[model samples]
Structure formats: structure tokens, C-alpha cells
Target: MPDLATFQREMRKAMVAGGVPSTTLEGAVVSDTLPAERRIRVHQNNYRESLCRALMSLFPVARVFVGEQFIKGVFAKYIAREPPCEAVLSHYGAGLPDFLAEFAPVCQVPYLRDIIRLEWAIHSLQLVEEFGNALSADGTPRLSPNVRLVDSDYPILNLWMAGTGQIPPEAVSLKAGGQCALVTLSGGEVRLAALDSAQRQTALRIEAGEPVEGDSLTMLTEMGAVDFHAG
Candidate 1:
């Protein structure tokens, strides 16, 4: 018989990988009378279900765009290709934006990937801000509770706002061009604000792993940032 630690590790692998049972323990091992394979099936279903729920919560607008079947397919592929590495399941769908970019089926809907990226940012910001009490001086919050920065060639703000019922229904024309937005939590509420040229430049600099401070803002302004705000 394998030791307890080995048994647990093997069980976890079998549960996630969907293969023949490796342990000798019967159905009694998993609190079910079904055969080991069936029990494993249940585990598989549970795992996929949990992941789907997480994705849905993070990207409801994306879900609406792709519909149910396509989303299920995406979730299935995501689980098989990129299983959760960290204990926190919120981080599981972080790769979804890149996946959508490469996914051939949704290539025509280019804005879809950017929309998912925005949603993921919001989800992550909410989780992080909830845990840390980081605050700026004079009681002014430094990082918004939800960090939703949009860096896309597509009009993600319009699509997201339309999906969430913030924009009028008739205003959401498919032909609308691309735009960038920043979703942040201000005064304990989530707010989606449009990003100006300067902010976009700053975001680009920060995303490139460059330090964004005084000189960076100056460079951004020189690079054609019409209306720069000091935040």
C-alpha cells in the first residue's frame, strides 16, 4: 500500500487527469459506493464545474459574447491545458486572455480577448485589495480596490459597459471603434473611467516592466499625450 502522502498525491493526479485508478482502495476511499472510475468521473465533473464558475464570475460579459457551448469548450481546454497552480482558484484563468488571442474560432471577434483581460484585472484587484490594508497618506487610497486597466486596440469599454447595462442598448453598434478604459475602485465602489493618451502611455511603460514615475510621465506627455492628469 502506498503511504498516506503518496496516496493523496496520486489521488489528486487521478482526479484531475481522468485515468484509471492507481490506488487499491475501493469506493469507500472517496465516500461513495460507485466504482472507482465513476467516482473519478464525479471528481472530474466537480473540477470542471468549479473552474467554469470561476470563469463565469470573472468574465460574465465574455460569457455573453461566446454563448454557453463555446464557453464550456474554452473552459474544458483551459483546465486540460492550464490547470490551477496556486492554491487560490481566482488565479486560474489568468491565461485566458492569451488563450483567446490564439484561439482560432474567436479570432474574428478580436475585442473578446481584451474584454476578458479587463474582467480578470477587476477580479484580481478586488481579491488583492481585500487582503492588504495598503493606504496612501492623508487617507487617500493609493491602489484602487479593483485594478481594471485596459490596454487594447479594441473598444473594450463600450462592449463591457453595454454588456453590464451601463450604456444604452441602441448605443452599442457593432461598428464602434476601439477604446481604452481604466476600471478602479474609488470610495469603496467600482468605477470604469476612460483612459487618456497620457494614461495609456503610462500603462504601456508600466506593462513593459519599466519604472513609471516623474520622467516617465514627462516622456509620455512629450509622446503626444494631449491632456495629462497627475492622478
Candidate 2:
């Protein structure tokens, strides 16, 4: 009889790899009319099913872009290559954007990877349990968590909006160009807003890990940002 540790290791390998030594699970430890390989097959199917469902929830827009058949194919390929490490499914697809980028089949859709990144960000923001105190008394929010506001050239906000169906279908022209965006959480809701020059400067400073005060406001005014309130 294989020890518990060795049995667990072989089971994991088979669960993710679909092929383990048939005798790995052979022993009198457990009763079974079914062979060990057949039992392992059941586990593999369950793993695939759970992983596909998790991916579907995380990347609905990607699923829409690629039909169910294609998505299933991609998911199967990805799962066989990359299995879950953490207990939480939310973190499972963190590398999906990179995976999609190198995937030969989806090379035609260049924007698909970026869209996946946006979806991942949205998922992460939703999962974050604590946020910095950045709102004003009037209910307007401020960007207070370092300088994440001014980071990234990807127009991530628009990309996220487009992916999640928050933007109008007709308005979603991929070639329409990028825009500066402000991302914030308020009253348990995530909000995205366009940023003007001043806000952008302030956001830059915040992102650069600089101190904010009167001087930041002056720079923001020069950039045509009259509103410093968070969105």
C-alpha cells in the first residue's frame, strides 16, 4: 500500500496531468470495483468542470468573444498547462492574460489579452476587503491609495467598462483611442471616471508615492482639473 503522502502526490499529478502510473493507487487501502485509472478520471473531469466554470465567471466577455466551443478548447488547453495552486478560484487566472498572448489560436484577436487583464483587475478590486479612506464629507471620493490612479497606459478603465457591458455597445469602438481614467471604490461600489489634466497630475504624484498638498492643487489647476473629488 502506498503511503498517504505518496498517494496524494500521485493523485494531484493525475488530476492535473490526466496520466499517472495506473498502479499508483493500487492497494487494499480503499475498496473499489472501478480501477484506479477510472477513479482518477472522475477527479480529472471534476477539476476541468470547476475550472471552466470559474473561467466563465471571470472572463464573460472573453467567453462572448470566443464561443463556447472555442472557449472550452482554450480552457482545456490552459488547464492542462496551468492548474490551480491557491484554494481560491479568483486567483487562478492571474496568468491568463500572458497565456492568451502566447496562445497561437487567439493571435488574431490582439485585444483579447488586454480585455482579459481588465477583467482580472475588476475581479481583484471586487475581492479587496479594505480600501483607504479617500472620500470627502460631501460623498465625493478621492484617490488615496498611493498613485494607482495615474498608472498604466492601457486605458484600463475603458477596457474594463467595455468588457463588463458597462459601456454602450455602439460606443465600443476598439480603435477609438485611449483616455485617462480614475478608478475608485465608494459605498461598496466601484466607479470609473475620466480624469482631466490636474487630476492626472495629482494622480501621477500619488502614484509616484509623493506627498500631496497645496502644490499638487496648483498643478492640477494648471492641468484644467477643477474637481479633485474621487469618482
Choose the strongest candidate by lDDT.
1
Q: Could you tell me how far off, in angstroms, the CA of residue 111 lies in candidate 1 after the best superposition?
A: 1.6
Q: What's the lDDT for candidate 1? A: 0.67
Model 2 spans > 4 angstroms off: 20-22, 26-34, 134-143, 146-170, 194-231
Model 2 per-residue lDDT at 149: 45
lDDT of 2 at 35: 71
Task: Report the Cα lDDT for residue 211, model 1.
Answer: 50
Off by over 4 Å in 1: 19-33, 130-148, 168-170, 173-175, 202-231
User: How does model 2 score by TM-score?
Assistant: 0.69
lDDT of 1 by residue, 1-231 (tens): 567887778777775776576656443265446666676667768887888887777788887777888877887777777788887877789898777777888876677888888888777766664323333344321233345567777677888888788887577765766576776654455566666676676756654545556654554333332223345
